[model samples]
Target: MSRARLSPALVVGAAISVVFVASALLSLVWTPYDVAAFDIGHRLEGPTAAHWLGRDHFGRDVASMILLGAGNALAVSLVAVLLGAGLGVPLGLLAAARRGLIDELVMRASDVAFAFPALILAILLTAVLGPGAINAVVAIGIFNVPVFARLTRGAALSLWTRDYVLAARMTGKGAARISLEHILPGLASVLIVQATLQFSLGVIAEAGLSYVGLGAQPPAASWGKMLADAQTLVSVAPLQAIFPGLAIVVTVLGLNLLGDGLRDRFDPRLDEER
Candidate 1:
């Protein structure tokens, strides 16, 4: 299907996405100082001297923690997104293609998953799996699967009824071949939109889990964990919470705007408006 070029919203979203991606990548190579490095002399110091964002209660550099924390947040989001998309997309495709017992089973399972919110799932998983980064990933990923599965299935269902799909069937294209060759291409725009939406959700979920202490542990520096650590200090050291909270808000906002722009740019219905 034909589509219009990117709009202003998309351009801004792209810039924001690039910034966060670069920040995460840079954190892998270097931060101004080691995120965990502490000096008692610098404890609770405001932004000045050697520390740009100042030091935490333990004298660890806040700016450094932010960099490393951004990296961790990105990492968790990526993994959770990948896991959800990988598992959910195939199920959606299969449900659309198979459309019988298999579809019934898959859809039912996805519905069951829908009963629990991502945060609730995270809390449950944390209880079962115990607090850590991996557990957070799994919890978020699990919640994502149902969302992607339902979205993909709906999109694929629409495609399955298309004339091209009927034509493919007339040519004796097998279900798998028709799905890959005819259906998937049509669904790409939908998947891209869904992915960005999910990415934003993943960020929120990660932060929520971390805020509750079920996310990345202390000293490892996740944005959520940073907020958790700084909650008590907010009345006195507001910067401790503000920076990490702003990071989460900005990142999620960028993803959401990007997702909306993508839907307007690529979807055939929206393209007709242009």
Candidate 2:
């Protein structure tokens, strides 16, 4: 087997993702200072040898907070995407296999889901379930469901019309078997690209929810919460906000670039053009 070619964007994106993942993992084991520890004297101090990214208004080490915050962001995004893809992929596959009323129903349900924005859905869920990381994940996951479902349905529909799919049908292969063995494999690249894009969106959605006090609660050290806290002290200590903001931007950019790279790599039309 030949090794797959790596795109420059994919390499850079993967590097960025690795760095963040490593930081998050390291934070799980150790942080320079207690993420919750506060010192009035050190509050809002600029970066120093002792505290690389300085301290927040509460005197919590910004670097430590960011490190741990990465973990929170990744965890939420990962769960959200998993939940979305887990349910959405099946529904999409089922719809594609059945077509007619089932497809209409699935697509219509997705439309209804798309009608509500993530933030609004988050707020609604928070009202019913109260605020936390799980709620945020559910909200984001719900939002992602329609996206994957639509993409899967479209991709699977195309595959269903192909000669191999017809041959499998003629060979007495059930829809479920054919979808699992054939359609799903063909849709893997597309799903992967979609997942990357959705993961980034989930991260941003989690941050937005957290910023609005609907995500990870106090002492959790979410990037969004950090930004929310820093907004009041932006002028006095811009780094507090800057560090978390930069984290969000870098994470999203990396995922998006990775998705683009994967799309270019997987799409045959793009290969033909090259």
Candidate 3:
């Protein structure tokens, strides 16, 4: 098979993702200042020799919080996507394989999920479970399930009609076996692209939740929470909001670009169109 050409979007997205990932990981070892430590003496201090990005209204290091926030955002989004794709992929496969009522039921359920927005679900979940990172993950993950299920089911439906699938059926291969071995593999590229897109959505969802006090509670740095905290201070300490805002924008853009690139690479029709 011929190697796929790397697109500019893919390269740039990868580079941006690498920077965020590296900063997040590096935060595990060191930050300019302790994330939780605060100093009333230095509240709202601008960039200087001591604090690179300056300080928040609470006198906490903005740079440190940002670095740690990257980890938080990445963790929550990663778990949300995993929960979504893991359960969604299999359910979709089952629906496609069984057809008839099974397919209808699954599709209907996805519609129900789609009816409830992620923020609404997060609010409800937080009300029931109390706000935290885990609840954010669960709420976001639940919301994501329907998205993956629909995508997977749609992609698998196409694969089920392919020649190899017919040959497998002729060889006495059961629906489950064929789906696991053949159908799933055929849908990998589509699923991957979908996963990347969903991951960016997950990050945004988590941020939105955190912004409203439903995610990664107190002392746990989050980009959304950072924005929330900085909103009032924007007139004075704009850097506080700016840094986190940029983090969210850059991360989402990178993931989107990566997803678009992957779709182009995997779908021959897209390449031809380009």
Scored by lDDT, the top model is: 2
For 139-239, candidate 1 gives per-residue lDDT tens digits of 88888888888888888998899998999999998999988898888888888898888888888988888888899887688888888888899998999
Total backbone collisions for each predicted model: 0, 0, 0
- Determine which window of 10 residues in candidate 1 has minimal summed lDDT: 1-10
TM for candidate 3 is 0.96
Shift of residue 233 alpha carbon in model 1, Å: 0.9
CA lDDT scores, all candidates in order? 0.86, 0.89, 0.88
Give the per-residue lDDT of model 3 (tens digit) for 1-274. Answer: 2227788888887788788789888887888888677788999899888888999888899999999998898888899999999999999999999999999999999998888877787678877888999989998898888888999899899888899999999999999999999999999999989988888888898899899998999888999999999899888889888989999999999989888878878888775665
The candidate 3 region of ten consecutive residues with least summed lDDT is 1-10
Q: Which ranking of candidates, highest TM-score first?
A: 3, 2, 1
List per-candidate RMSD values in Å: 1.9, 2.0, 1.7
The residue ranges of model 3 lying beyond 4 angstroms of the native Cα positions read: 1-3
Model 2 scores worst on lDDT over the 10 consecutive residues at 1-10
Model 1, runs deviating above 4 Å: 1-5
What TM-score do all the candidates reach, one by one? Answer: 0.95, 0.95, 0.96
lDDT assessment of candidate 2: 0.89
Residue range 75-188, candidate 2, lDDT tens digits: 999999999999999999999999999999999999898888766876787768778998889888888888999999999999999999999999999999999999999999
